[model samples]
Target: MTADPSSGAAHDALAGSLKRTEIQRAPLSVAGREIVQVRTEIPPGVESGWHIHPGEEVGYIVAGTVEMRIAGRPTLLLQAGDGFLIPPRVPHNARDLGPGVGEMLSTYLVEVGQPLAAFTEPPDSASR
Candidate 1:
């Protein structure tokens, strides 16, 4: 398929947004917790580096293949309808498994004393 000239720019914006996404952050047992939801399309050869989350991340592979690595374990392949959870502070990285488009939806549980700032850009040193 022909790629739109703006596709790259749009993906970059999406990645930037993901890097900065946040929910309501508070101390222990605080009130008014907020959850953050982000959905973005990913092109081939793109990936998120090794990182950790302050709150729990529950996600499903709605379309295409997503390869994920939890902490130091081997990368696990996930397909449509497959779901996984990443607990707080557990390092993980993910990427598309093929040279095709894919999408995933993620919801972070930021309720009741969740730390929003824990969601951040991964370090540059991690690789696929």
Candidate 2:
């Protein structure tokens, strides 16, 4: 699916932090599902705010270093050649921890008509 630049103010707000380039999108054999591939670039010290996907996301770190924080799980320190998976609706965030830009390739199997990702309040925010 193509991202509409003028989609909404929320999307524009999120885009300011992380750069996401859609690589390909195709319909999946499963009814009501589609696969979307994206290349994301994160600047040093930037964190992808906590968010949830409509389905599952399979991602591979392509460059630099990153820390993956999935709610309820131990944080993972990843580098190029490392891969991770996020189950449907699980809140997670990726932070660039690098001397240079960090890049990741993510492929998602998601339900059609829903945004690929939806940002949410941090899981631990309630305690703050």
Candidate 3:
């Protein structure tokens, strides 16, 4: 409900270096819904803690490679321009894998009839 906390620190991007500016908290249906256009930047050798989401995920690697793991499965390395899709409620996580940094556009979709609230973050019990 509060404004999204800014990244504060700088990170690399597809076009050039960037700083986190905004994360538009979005709504999703039970099956899922796409996320708003919130930009992301990751620094070289840096990674985020594993986390989960309520919606199914589909993404395109806009720049660089990413190591993706669904349900804690073996990581699949994705390169720039590559795309992937994850089923709903399937625990998954990804980290920038290419040298320097990487970028991607992510989306989650929901089937007809599902409530939008179902599209949200994982249960409080998940890791960060």
Q: Name the candidate that leads on TM-score.
A: 2
Model 3 bad stretches (over 4 Å): 1-35, 110-128
Per-residue accuracy of model 3 over 1-128 as CA lDDT, tens digit each:
11234643222121133233334435544333445333455565555434443455567777877777665455678888788887766655557765867776665454433321222343344444
How accurate locally is residue 26 in candidate 2, as Cα lDDT from 0 to 100? 93
Per-residue lDDT, model 3, residue 81, is 76
Off by over 4 Å in 2: 4-13, 125-128
Cα lDDT tens digits, model 1, 18-122, are 332222222434455445554545566566655665577888777778888786455679888888898877777777776566577777665554343333454
Query: 76 in model 1: Cα distance from truth in Å?
Result: 1.3
TM-score of 2: 0.88
Prediction-by-prediction clash tally: 0, 0, 3
For each candidate, what is the lDDT?
0.58, 0.85, 0.52
Error in Å for residue 12 of model 3: 20
Model 2 scores what on Cα lDDT?
A: 0.85
lDDT by residue for model 2 (33-88), tens = 99988888999999998888989999999999999998888889999999999999
